[model samples]
Target chain A: MLNPVIEMVDLTKKYRSFTAVDCLNLTVGKGEIFGLLGPNGAGKSTAILMMLGLTEPTSGMVSVCGINSTRNPIEVKRKVGYLPEEVGFYDNPTGMENLLYTARLNSIPESEAKKRAEELIERVGMAEAKHKKTGKYSRGMRQRLGLADVLIKKPEVIILDEPTSGIDPQGVRDFLQLIVSLKQEQGLTILFSSHNLHQVQQVCDRVGIFVKGKLQSVGDIESLSKQLFTESLCLIEAGIHEFPAENTDTKPVRKLLEPINGIAKIEHKKGVFEIECTSDLSATIAQTIVNAGYGLNFLNKKEYGLDEIYNRYFEGGIQHG
Target chain B: MKEGYNMVKKKVSEDTTGNQKKVKRPAKEKPKHPFWVIVNKEVSDHVRSWRFIILVALIALTCLGSMYTALNNMGDALKSSKTGELFFFLKLFTVSDNTLPPFFVFISFLGPLLGISLGFDTINSEQNRGTLSRVMAQPIYRDYILNAKFTASMIVISVLFFALGFLVMGLGLIAVGIPPTAEEFLRVIFFIVLSIFYVALWLNLSILFSVRIRQAATSALAGISVWLFFSIFFNMIVDLIAKGLAPSSFAPEYVIVKFQKMILNLMRISPAQLYSEATTTLLMPSVRSTGPLTMEQVAGAIPSPLPLGQSLLVVWPQVTGLIAVTILLFALAYVAFMRKEIRSS
Candidate 1:
């Protein structure tokens, strides 16, 4: 059995009467990219702060690399690298100077620090802007420099809070690719938080959906969809050029598809009939609709993506309360 | 999914093997202490800043202007009386004509400005720029940042004052053609050290405000307000209070004496009063005491200046009071900073 590199055991944080994080128990295995997906004000940032020991939890424990973070933060800090949301550096110093200062703070030797900074600068694709003042750099450039800043200490676990919040679409794609490469090439365990479900699905091995400071669901995308829907759903859309002499009549298609074992429901609107059923049933239903002498103009099966799964869970939560 | 699992397994094995070797190598090289690292970075940042340059230049220009005036008067005195042996070097710092106050007075007045300017933004600016959290995330204790900031700024202040002192001494030697005696040289050195401590008190106060106030501008304003109250209005307020307590002129001599003592103790609460009294005793040896002396006590005394040891005794309490206040302010700032929430943006 392999041990998790980063673990939170019933971690909780509260400010006055408001609980920001409520008994969060998370485990990130070695060499895993875990995306913490939630909307704004959902305790993602607070949880990251607690994990890095930058904030004292109201209760519970957080351990990084097997060291209790609250009890021994300095030891944990040495092994963990954190890139805060909208990370800022000393504006007056050049990018190289900023990285060198961070390296020195981590107690790396001067010569070695310089070499590592240069290597990281090139790796993050900021070699051209290494000598420029960080204040003059663009948001994308600053984010790249921030990535290099986190890697200078060669941390085993990296924590990023909303790393792609304000970046452009292309830059977000490029940045996510860079993060994936870092995990693969350097074998760093990464835990990043974001509100963008689609982006998280692109790079994360597993994701935890947070709602109102609670972990509503936690698993890979496929497993989460299974847990939410119980059975995979497929939708069949068929066009009807002619109705049965009535605008509200869906009887002909209903009569043909009602007896199918996995067909759950059928909805008719404006000349198109939609049929919902279990997996691989869309083809059989489409054949049935055509066999009943209706014009099957088009058929499509919609698999559940993270966006739909998130909406279902979040909406369910709202309606329940 | 199976492919991803296989890739992750391979990477983890590679990492464990590589981490073992890399960890062994770093263990051999002892890490530098966090104190020195913070000190080095802060020193470089302060020295290269435009604020330090402008402040140092202002002090230098004013000091030279006062020194020039003192030198002209000393030349005239040397020609007339030829009595420059007592504190020839000390005269360069303390002697002034009607054109200006002496160098000691100028420093005691403007020294707080240097301190407040250096420290008003030390912690708050870091917090506003969002660098405090990042720096605190490093492998260092929380208090190291505050302590290093004070130490680095103090080092800069000492260097500036010592350099200016030496420059004045060298110029005086060339202009007046007289070297200071051993006692005079020691007195000048002691004055410089005392001036550093006095300015450090203001620096610590400003840092305390910086920790308490969220905005750098507000902290700077608060620091200056304290300086202004002490420098300008505190003595007047103390006088009013003493008079209100003992208003009758026909009161007994003992009553008057007690009220006067109360007034003097009240004034000593201000660092400006303490610094000015200490420096006056050090630079002007003829001033034997700070309080009023009775006629009987003064009748038997000779009209000679006190020695360096006795002058030190006269000002020892003031010196210690300044130090105590400085430490108290610094301790308050340290506790406030250590307990502050790092994520409160």
Candidate 2:
């Protein structure tokens, strides 16, 4: 990642005997949206807190914007905006007032804070409801105001914990769309943690799956599938019907493909031969079949959705989540 | 009295003579103090809260009613005034009728309720609202939340007590047709300062409970229970202990006095006891001592009202104790809040 804005190297946090985040090592580059996907109590929130310098790690280090959060949390806080999983506001204050108060906490000048607050309120689609007390706001409205609240500080990196958990489907779509625009138009790096896989899949440029305090995989969809599916890829299909062959028997193709690496069993019918491999051997199988004087047809590697990927690596935590 | 807090560090104006000006000035300026936004927001919250409004109205009605009775009795006190009874204005605070307590007595009673009402849910309600972590994630110290709540509450207390004190004095001036002497004025200001410390003790106690308890109602209950334990039950407990370990009638008089002093010291453990003693000494001025004084100490003393300095000397331990206990409670709350896990509800 170029100019990584958020980095956690070997980060660990333990509460007495139970480890919350174990050896978390990840980097989020500038202007990137990194989603931390996990089940509840899977330590995603803990890692986010440590990244924001809100919770001290039991071991290792977390740095935000190149400032070691553990050593100088205040400096990190000045540049990083964190929206907790359950965003809260003072009940009596209007949404407008709440955003202004956050602006003040960040030491924004009075006029500047007001201007930024008004702009953000409008940008987050909260202009009509900004005058209403936050106590009367719906959960989704509060989440939107929470977005505006984090932006009032003009932060370089925005860390959101479950930004779309309790919203309706349409609201979630709008909120996720706003987050992407905020990153693209303003060049803000965004890191959000979510237990919902669909939300993570929709907006994240890259993702890390957390299971029981450990990161199982971290990459974009294709790369993550590549990392996860390469090991368990048991079936390989090679078609050889294009080239005319006098022999119409299965023994010829099976004999050609059986010598490939990681092949456990072979079955042949018509022009397609199925090779069962203990590990990924698609490349070697294609090369051997083509080199043995048979026209190599097509290679198959299973395309996976996040659900299948989630179920594959997070089988133990799936039901609980 | 940790006076120069970082957030409210008022470099607004250096005129120490005017209390109201100092109180009202910093709030109008550009927020130079970090988290002045929080202090300002919290102050407005307390002012707008119905709970705070009700408590202030209660204190106001009771103080005004007591002051009215004190006004009615001022004629008799004036006619029977002695040679050294120079504080005619001070009499309005201490002179009580059969039906009502004096002005100071009413304050001591309701001040704790006011403090607890403002602070019992200071931390827990914010946690329940899910704002604690969001605020703590800002570029400020964790102690800022607790300290700012405390500072704002203390500001309200000081403003209310001062306003009430000046209001009563202004009414007394209109009715009694006499202004307070300089000494009496200083004594009344000192009394208001003392009441701030008293209410501050309760405020810090309630904040401590808020930091430790997860539920707002539970923390409020815990604060009230402690107040009840100290105010009503403490004297009874001390009496029971005294009766259990009383020196016999056959014992030496010095031994009996020593035993009585021990019991008195035990009774002083309650904050109300210390506040009342300090109030009586400072407001009455004729109160020579707070404890049993031997003949030798009282041998050459004249039967006259002590000056403000001597009265302060008399209650120095109580005032210091109030300040000390208030700071100690604040420190305890600060440490608890800083170390607390930043979980939202």
Every candidate's CA RMSD: 8.2, 8.4
Stretch of 10 with least lDDT, candidate 2 chain B = B6-15
Candidate 1 lDDT, B262-289, residue by residue in tens: 8888898889989989999998887888
DockQ of each: 0.38, 0.53
lDDT (tens digit, per residue) of candidate 1 on A1-321: 186999998999999999999999989899999999998899998998888777889999999999989889999899998888878888989999999999989989877998999999999899999999998988888888888999999999998888887889998999999999999898999998999988899999999999888888789998887777755366676676665325687776788888999888888876667777776687788777777777767777777898888888666553322
RMSD of 2: 8.4
lDDT of 2 by residue, B90-202 (tens): 99998875789898888888889988988999998888888998998789988788888899999999999999999999988998888899999999999999999999999
Show what share of the native A-B interface contacts model 1 retains.
Answer: 0.55
TM-score of predicted model 2?
Answer: 0.85
Over 4 Å off in model 1, which ranges? Answer: A231-249, A269-273, A278-280, A313-321, B1-32, B75-85
Native interface contacts kept by each candidate, as a fraction? 0.55, 0.70
Off by over 4 Å in 2: A231-302, A316-321, B1-32, B78-85
